[model samples]
Target chain A: MDTLNAGSVSAMLPSAFPIVDKDWELADTYTLHFATDGAFDFDPGQMVMISQPGVGEVPISISSNPDVHDRMSLTIRGSGSVTRALGRLDYGDVVGIRGPYGTPWPLDTAIDQDLMIIAGGIGLAPLRSLIYRALARRSDFRNLTLLYGSRDPQSLLFERELHEWRGRFDMEVEITVDRSSPEWMGEVGLVTSLVDRARFSEADAVAMVCGPEIMMHFVGIALTDKGMHPDNIFFSMERNMKCGIGLCGHCQLGAEFLCKDGPVFSLSRIEPLMKVEEL
Target chain B: MAHIIDIDGLDGLIASLKAEFDVIGPIVRDGLIRYGPIGSVADLPRGWTDVQEGGSYRLEPGNTEALFGFVLGPDSGKTNLFPPRAPMWTYREGSFSATPDSTRPMAIIGLRACDLAAIAIQDEVLLNGPYVDSHYAARRSQLFIVAVNCTTFATNCFCTSMNTGPRLESGFDLGLTEVLDDHHFVVHVGSEAGASFLAGLDQRQATSDELAEADQLIDITANSITKRLDTTDIAQFLADNLESPRWSAIAERCLACTNCTAACPTCFCTSPVDTTDFDGSAARERVWDSCFSLDYSYMGGDPVRSSGSSRYRQWMTHKLGTWIEQFGTSGCVGCGRCITWCPVGIDITEEMAAMRAEVLAKEAR
Candidate 1:
């Protein structure tokens, strides 16, 4: 507490600049690709707080694989003041970055076991990192299946990667839309329905899900119905996070600070709280 | 080392401390005893004590003419350390700079044992946690604490059950116990600075009998506390009974006014707000927040805790239950300010006892 020594004082400051190298517009959301300064080190499910200074800061998940350390990407929709400001930035613009905070997905638990990933809408952003990490270490994992659903075909993220992943012999990718137009040829239903068609050994497969809270809850029920253990299912939660280091109480859920203890938690741990209304 | 000083010597002690520090002590303000800067011994709440109960607090004349006769007020040491609102940093254009207020060393006098315990809880949450809040750290490191051993207990007080109050054992630079019968004060030096401060005062080594008298007085105050809460595994019990119907029953009368959390010395929840000036310069400010507030759990539109029931549950569970899990200690110091300040007379000890009773009855059935 001795004047918070210079090093610890600067911990909250987002001094690192990650310049946008390329930007892609997918429907209402934009994905910014940045070449890291080699100073940013993170895990697949870790996230960084990005700020535009005069505007504000928001926690965005690292949407790219951690193995690709030289580059990073964050897919953000224009939801709030900070995101709207982020959406306005052009290529070569600099955004302040701090932290790769929160517990990463339990990828180690899925090693040498069949893995299933379910994503809804833009919830696919954080899961994209896990998917890429699993793909990069494909030999270490058994059968891999990704069940993704969007509001419609246009809302799907990583469209190009989804196509390439479907062609890969080692990965099974299923694409679905809530409502599809005539041009769409894939399944049209909720993402939970894709879990029914997904073929995996319930006893050995680990499921990782990320989406709206309502969707994740239903998907959790579907996974449980398939004879999946509650401990084997992980879900990433979203809350108002001010300080990613857990000092701010904005992300508190029960005894846990989602920013520190988890953004990703096992169903067995959070199921009871999640079942309680307005908790 | 322990020292004894005549009751009149308090003026000289205050004068000595005022030379180098902002001496803050209990003073009568608007018919209430509150901690504020005291310019002289005249500002102290002399010959006054407080009558505190659920939904009421009033200042009353003390039977003995002692300066530190009052038990405690709504505010504690945390009001200065954490503060209601503080600027974390200022931002303009694309750069940000943190300006932590490190000036003005503070000498807080008349802190009760329970308040000291509450400050320790804040230290664990704000200073020793995974992240250090720079604002809290800068202010806390400069504090000079002078704790007062309680000689009186209000009806709402339950510090005996919490094992944190009515006597000063640790977490203070200097400790004082009033011996009104002898018209003197027994002082214990807790640190090097405290020893030096006592050395400068016109004081003498305390007699063993005088020290024993002070211990007896504190023991009397501790035993006089009638209010109590059974804390044996209470945290785990509350955690297990999250869905209990007692919460709804309490919610029927509980008002989410947030007064309890505001007066709570250890409730360290805060919200960061970003404000921009006309010149396009913006600064992020950290303000005290309570879980009882609907917006404390707001993500965007509807808050997670929308009902009075959920908000009340969140506050009690976090304070008496989950706080131990998160910070390795119970958040409640049993100071009883929450009970006195609550608008609807929702006593936390009563609720806890009721919950335990319901659990026990269910088990029996």
Candidate 2:
């Protein structure tokens, strides 16, 4: 019976922010950076509902490092009308930004545990933020390793950051591609194949994975087969959501509202529903 | 304090209230009694009774001239509180702004016990969550309820099974029950506003005998409903039987036409639809969307629940099973609107029994 307060009702409206910079990973995918107006802080792995005023809205995970406040970024693929509209925007062209919402990676739990990260295609966007945080406290985490893959040598995202992390002595980085070019000297295979070479403490290891739905499922089995504890393995779940909160039912996966309870869930938590087809 | 008011006094009360607030009540339209704005006492559906069962609703002439001679109609009080289409906000002239609250101070008449429970469930879904829905909050802030206790039953009614009805316990401004045999309504003033409104209307203090009659009448309604649904471990039962063959059986008849969800008062799922004008004005409104819709479960490519069996499973399991995990309460009030409005007579209670029967048969082996 609690009624609305004396003030006006709060609407879920996004403020238009000017795109300060843009980075292209490929012809169809890019990332837009913005300067935040005020104090807006979010944990890694959280997403924002990016909108083109007249086009539409799409939920995109925040890719920029969480350590830096006052600056935000969303790496979007020009796959749909709304994203296409956002992709066309350049320096100073404004787009509405609505959140930094959803649960973040369990970085606190992974402390002192050997960390293994797996990402495919644009899936590295959210994990990229986590990687930055993990590297910031490198001594706190033991044996940090990242295994990443893409469709081809030409399509890997964050090429500059990948090169930087690859050269670091503290972290081990392995990259692969489904279809390789003649000039490509790195490993050429599905990301799961790279799991055979990556090493971690099997008894006290934590793995964070993100990719296509089917890819995540197979990678989960691969991680478990590699002796990683099922409970310690986490992956992200995606669904089309209109209202970034729990009200919109589009993002439902069985008992989970991916928008709120998680877009990130432990493998053990959703394994049953994932086994059931079309749940 | 409860007061006794005859039909004429009741009419006067409605008239006075109409002049002050926007009063809405049940009206007969398109051969169906639905909630609409009231102009006078004549606007209320009187001298009419409805025969409601699975997939059937027929209005028949009533033997009594009493105003509340009928069971509840299809529209639950949910539409008045959380409307089917609500505009969230608008964007124009280089800025975004919230949709202005244009709703008037309003009163809704003839709210039944089952519908009131549904409203409370929606209140939890929209209000008591991690995020509050301001659109529902605005309209709900200005609502006044005139709850009418059920004195009759439709064949599909099972509020007694859900433990939600036959007598309203709370969440109403004013409570009423027509003692048809005694030709008077005992009004229970539930709020200070209700007491003040009644002071201006014609009414007398109810004698002890009159209050006793009201209690007995409500008791009769509770005892008369024959339909029953056993909710013993229903949540776990449905969850355990996720792949139950009973779902496929129900799906064969379920047209996926969304009639059940549309008639259900507590199905609060919605999807946003945006519109833009040539003058650079654009807005977003959330429309009531059904789980039965093929696109509701879409996750990029083909919909997650493309088959009818999975869609029906999503609807029923979400209502009976998963909702408990989400909101700590089953999302059904047992008003039986889903049963009565379904085109194929798909009854949820009957389906649950069938699923249980299948499990029982397996155990016996």
Candidate 3:
């Protein structure tokens, strides 16, 4: 065997990941599984490109935790032409994977610090990976809380995991909906509303919030009101990321490419992009 | 970095260079003089003109028997050097396929100052940014550019605000300002290729008076522009005007057809789509996409900027304000095609003026 040098290590890297499984998560939304040669490594919150034959590629955030599985998972929403085509894929179909790209969630940074995560709708998909990673290394962090909100009760994802996470006294998981029926027993309001009900020290605490921009804004405001510093808040941005490698200029927000510089950034660091009109 | 050549030797210089590389220049096609290969000087459009203003353009036949007639073309030099769409790689049978050869040496002639500046800006974005666009670098290395100072500004042109055009300053192998009165072009040799090209021409040494005339001409051309944008505090303007009624007004007339993006010189937004063939073969395509489209910002079965108002706001904000914060320059080149092709004639300069006036009115109140 070649002495496991850069060339040898690179040769073993998974350049193309084959689609082995796919499932519809909701109407026009999908969860796709790709078989990578176990050597393929990625941290949670990073995204991979899924390409369809004769159609095009769409960047899907890795929904599954990287520490536990040999196969990588991507949660994609059908909106544009590419995702619309991906929504039609079945098992054993193949899609190209470009990267495990972008700055991974600072799971290592969150160690020993209390964590508060707020995810809305599909935004929960990327946050779920971080949540799972946090659970895997639960002893490393102090307090863990997940606040999730969606359009309705039927649209909630990973319902079983939410129930399991709630059982642990060390962790708290709250699910809210914009609108709910009588059968729904959880909180009945936006995810931002749940912040007041949780208890945590603003010092040595960080909040990783991902969701609709408007929802994230409201959540950030709530966190600030609770004495969380802007530097302690993090959010993942969503743009029309055509090329995950930053070549296409589509995902640019101020000098940063959401693909290369960050899809995840501190609220303070990305303030310019947030303040700018289009980004 | 090499020898100097006189201004009169330009035609002979291009002719000599044609033997070694494909020489392309502006030619009349599709109602405009767009960049394409030329066999001889006769193939160039002799008399053409454009009426331009912010976001507006109209072509008219010109009086002077000049080869390059239009003020600026719809397509910038980008399509020649860095095409709108290109194949990165193709995968087949569980393996990657080799992309076709993208290397080629070509000489581009009659590139306007604004277009040349736009190319330089793209170089910083695509070739010299954090991650180099290898494809663009390959094309950029093998190409030669001959910059032409504008004789007149189009009505829609606003390169002055962007500090881009009406005069050629840098980033060219050769620069030429048309001076038909004396049947001479005041030329400036900027590179070795330019020096060699000028060596073959029958030209006279440029005197201080001649150079001064060129300066005066460039000043006149710059002043002829009918449009100007105050971009001094554009980022702050957009930030403050997020809830401005102008966004809704613009959206009310917008069809979201994306024609403006198609004609824009700096709009580089795109989206990828995939396709499969029989026998399990597959390919992915990089297609030009616009943020003006309603679906460009969709996430999780819901659209961000879903309303037409939001989409229009995104487009204008990205172009005039956010782009500056991102690329260190306003994305507009003052080419004026976006205004001309807007279908609804939603001029960007007018929008800026309205916003400026609105701000002033509020301050007065």
Candidate 4:
């Protein structure tokens, strides 16, 4: 790991990135689009540290398309202090940005195979990048299906994009919600139920999932139950982290630092760990 | 490669190092022998040794005037290298600028073998990662280590068990073995800087017999360590025993004081905090955080490890078990600071033995 001589990749100080646009995805969730300075780039599943000047930093996955140069979008929910501050920012306001850290979604592994992107709640944010990349290279794979679930129809992220994706002839998009409103025309049930109902070549497909830890866990089980190989099931996990690199030990799950070794990990690597209580 | 230097020669070596670097060595501070700035040999804690036991550490006058007689205090090279509080960057208006490393190049004198090993572990974490910590890298690049092989052992000292020490194998500028009988040091120069520094000291090549004496001196402490940990499949064992009842027992006695982690050399978890002033200049500072702290593992609402049982398990298992898988080596150096400084005397070795005993007892039945 003599990466020091490779080049300086220190994120000690974050560069200022201006918020070019802000989209309120939901009541609390906002997709803040930033004008990248072209200093660095990131992959679909890789996350960046977004910080407010007075508030602290939080690790948020890249939400927008990787091919889209000049602008990077981060889908953030106003849950904590840093994120809440980020939610309050408007276009032209500047915030500190460090990163594009952690392992990216193994998108190349999905080539020539069916790609199933399963997302729950805010989990869709990380997979949105992958969806964009996959759609761009649609001919490379056999089938591309997205089975997305939210708490409610109102809480659904990327509503406009989901609408566009569903209208596309090449890709398949199925939406589900736990509870339904009068305007809701989608299926009502757990995302796991959506996984069972979805059609895909399970044995040949690679499923990328993200959400709450428990949600991801059950989704992994659902994918496996649907005859998908556990190894083909990749998850973008979230944990408490300070340093997005492996320095801070907060984001540890067994031997893996979710910040470094993952944000994306196959079910084969982390299944045993998920079974252990409070691990 | 080796030199036999008398007491004055040792003093002269210190003087030479002091001239070039900000030399830090053990000195009596606040009734404890802690690593502090050493201007001269007089500043060193000579003729003093620490009596370390489970939940107790007392420094007293020893019979011999050995400069490096004591084992480790609460602090290690980590205290200086990866400080408890380090300002990373400051933000004003929009842009962020890193806090400059204005501190001088440092040379540590009397660093034990465990301390060196622990620094190496930290190097793997902070330096060998995908993104190197510039502050640690700067301090590490400018630092010189003068490791002293253990000639005496404390009750709490168990470096031999972990195979880290009693003898300074490498990772030092100069390695010293204090020959107690003759009041001289058998110095082993490990680097070009050490060789250059030794050229200025009043020293002579150690004879075959003197080298044998130094080996014998190291062996005395090495063999005296009664503390042992059976690390055979220890990682898997802890991984399997996560739900073991020992956690319950530990939770009963464990205070969750974070004393063990604070004293530990390889425990490198930190929390970044932001401070904003009236003038609108905000700074992000890193503070040493322990897993025992309720908020250390906070994600959204409640912390990951809320109970005392879970926190203790997290610390011990990570240090002895999962650390190997994480860092390619065991986290614990067996310096025994965790044992000695622990208020309830919660020994890690004893806990591991208890867990093993429980499993073995089940198998036997």
lDDT of 1 by residue, B221-247 (tens): 998999998999978898788888988
Error of 2 at B58 (Å): 1.8
Tens digits of per-residue lDDT for model 4, A153-208: 88898888998999999999888999999998779999999898888898789999
lDDT of 1 by residue, A1-279 (tens): 233332346456776365665556575688888777576788877888887766778889989878877788888888777888888888767677778888899998998889999999888999999998898888888999999989987788888889899999999999899999989988999998999778899999899999999999999999999999999999998887878888767787789899999999999998887887767
List where candidate 1 sits over 4 angstroms from the true fold: A1-7, A16-27, A91-95
What is the DockQ for all candidates, taken in turn? 0.44, 0.47, 0.29, 0.46
Q: Residue B82: error of model 3 in Å?
A: 3.5
Score chain B of candidate 3 by TM-score: 0.91
**Model 2 regions lying over 4 Å from their true place:** A1-11
RMSD of each: 2.4, 2.2, 5.3, 2.7
Model 4 chain B poorest 10 in a row by lDDT: B97-106
- Model 4 stretches astray by more than 4 angstroms: A1-9, A37-40
Q: Estimate each model's TM-score.
A: 0.94, 0.96, 0.85, 0.96
Q: Which window of 10 residues has the lowest lDDT sum in candidate 2 chain B?
A: B97-106
Contacts from the true interface found in each model, as a fraction, amount to: 0.37, 0.40, 0.33, 0.57
The candidate maximizing lDDT is 4
Candidate 3 residue B137 Cα shift, in angstroms, is 3.0
lDDT per residue as tens, model 3, A198-269: 788887888998887788888888998899898889998877776787766567665577888889898888
